[model samples]
Target: MKIGFIGLGVMGARMVKRFLEAGHEVFVFNRTPEKAEFLVKLGALRAKDIPSLAEQSDVVCSCLSMPEDSIKVFLDGVIPHAKSGTICLDFSTVGVDTSRIIYQKAREKGIDYLDTPVSGGPEGVENGTLTIMVGGEKEAYERVRSLLNSLGEKIEYLGGTGSGSIAKLINQYLVAVHSIAASEAMVAGAAFGLDSEQLYKLLKLSYGQSRMLERHMEQYVLDRNFEPGGAVKYVHKDVKLANQLFEQAGLTETLGKLAENSFSQAMSIGLSDLDMSAVIKPLEDKSGVVVKK
Candidate 1:
């Protein structure tokens, strides 16, 4: 399938590569031309803008920074330019209401839209092991299943137009809370004079094992490599979305709020560029227990 992709961030850049490797004709657009140039070097046709991208491809996939950005690209930029029946698949993690609105507008334009938020971070995208939760038309889901296989190992059609966003919100909540727990547990171990590496290995082997603990906490805390696999700012956005969803659903998730605050605190302390696991810094500051070498 000929595809037009937008947003060439860490995850987006890697994903565009997978499509090219699979022998698909790919056109790409990014707010910055430099990011799109890497893919252009690898045989991707660069679209000058969103409208140009929409004109050039049969299906368009977007993995933008936020829900609002996704809306602007599609509604403001691509909707008028897109050929009727062009598939607009959103891989950004955004709110359900936004997804619903976009889905409706896409349908009215005779376009197919899918809210397909993904999980497993940059590692997963590079490895094609990401988990995808999709929400859109059933027919569209079936039609795009094979294309999605290029990006994820596990894919599920959650329900209607916004179900994927809802599912992703739940995923963000668990990830946020578990990530905070991982940081706190590490700090507690360090305070008690337990080696961070030993505690990480032991906990990963025990009931406290989690995807976040294994992939994020272990690397940032043990290896002291704060390079972002998923940046603190991105996770902070996800947590904020989770908090909004929790409140809208009439449930107060205290732990979710606490996790949001912790990540926000991490961002405030100039850790936004670091990996999400850098939340350990705030914990260290609060308790006066160092986590790094």
Candidate 2:
């Protein structure tokens, strides 16, 4: 397949590499052309602009940062210029409303747009093990399944245009809430003088074990390395959008809001580029404790 890829940031860059390694003809574009240069060296083709990329590709894929970026890229660029019958897969984690808007716009152009938001990060992209949730016309998804298999080990077609966005937000909601809880627990244990590693080990062996706890403690918090798998700013944006979904469902108050606020604090405190596990930092500062090995 001739795949036009947009946004060559951390995860996007890795996904492009996977596609290139899988032997697809990948036409790449980025807002900053420098990011595309590395891929061009590795045998991917670089399109000068969005319309040119759209013009040449059989399918278009994007892994952008936010709702506004995805909206602007599709409405102004891909949807308008891509040939009819082209299938567009968005790997960005945006809200359901943004998904609906993009889907509507692409449908009007006779292009198939799927909200195919993904998880498993750059490592997953490299390993061809990303988990993908796809929402759009079933026929479009079926047609694209074989190509998607190169990126995802688990790809679920979840029905309707915005369902994938909804599903991804729920997954993000749990991730944010678990992150907050994990941070609090680790900090509390450390503040009270329990050996942080010992407690983490015990927790892993006990019912208290959670993926976030293990991830934050083992990979980041305990090591004091906050280089992001999922960055604080991105998680902040995702949880904020997840909170909006809760509000629309008539939820009065939720842990989603708390997770949103906590991540927001992490962003404001200049930890935005750090790992999402670094949400523990503000807690550590206030408690005068660092959960470390």
Candidate 3:
């Protein structure tokens, strides 16, 4: 398959590599040309622009940071230039409504659009073990299943347009709330004079354990290396999207609001670039105890 890939960030770059390793001909583009350099060297053809990328590809897959970025890229760059039969798969975690709007507009141009959001972070991308949730026409998804399999260990085609985005929003909601809960739990355990490492071991044996707890506590938080897996800023944006979905569904409030605020506080204190687990820093500061090994 001739593949066009946009947004060469942490996840995007690695995904492109997976395609290349699978022997797919990939045309790559990024706002920053330098980001495409490594992939280009790995046998990807660097597209001068989105139009050039779209001109030669059957599938154009994008993994942007925000909804607005996806909108701008498709509206200004992708839609106008892509061939009529081309399929556009967006792996960005955007609002459901936003994705539906894009899907409708793409249909007008005869471009098949799928809201295909992904989870499992950069590590998952690198290992081709990410979980992909897809929403679009059934036929289009079937056509792209092999391509998706190259990028994810688990891929599901949910209902129509925006369903994948809705699923992703729900995923982010649970992740945010669980992350905050993990932080609070660790901080409270530390405050009560429990060793962080021992507590984490015990928690893993108990009902309180979660993937978030294992990734956040054991890898990043306890080690004091806050390098991003999923950055606080990105997670915060996802939480906001989830909150918007809740409001649209006529819900008054959710625990996501609290998680949203926790991420906001983390960002305000300059933890935006750190891992989402860094939300614990604020709790650590207030309690005057570091949750570390």
Where in model 1 is the C-alpha error above 4 Å? none
Number of clashing residue pairs in every model? Answer: 0, 0, 0
lDDT for 91 (candidate 3): 93
lDDT of 2 by residue, 231-272 (tens): 999998999898899889998599998899999998888999
Model 3 reaches what TM-score against the true structure?
A: 0.98
Question: Residue 20 in candidate 3 has what lDDT?
Answer: 97
lDDT of 3 by residue, 1-293 (tens): 89999999999999999999999999999998999999999999999899889889999999999999999988888888999989999999999878888888889999999999999888898888999999999999999999999999999999999999999999999999999999999999999999999999999999999989999987899999998878999999999999988988897578999999999999999999998999999999999999998
TM per candidate comes to 0.96, 0.98, 0.98
Q: Cα RMSD for candidate 3? A: 0.9
- Residue-level error in angstroms, candidate 1, position 239: 1.1
After superposing candidate 3 on the true structure, give the runs of residues whose Cα lies further than 4 Å from its correct spot. Answer: none
C-alpha-based local distance difference test score of model 1:
0.89
lDDT per residue as tens, model 1, 9-87:
9989999999999999998988888988779889999887889889877899999888889889889987788998789
Quote the RMSD, in angstroms, for model 2: 0.8
Could you list the CA RMSD of all candidates, in the order they appear?
Answer: 1.3, 0.8, 0.9
Clashing pairs in 1: none
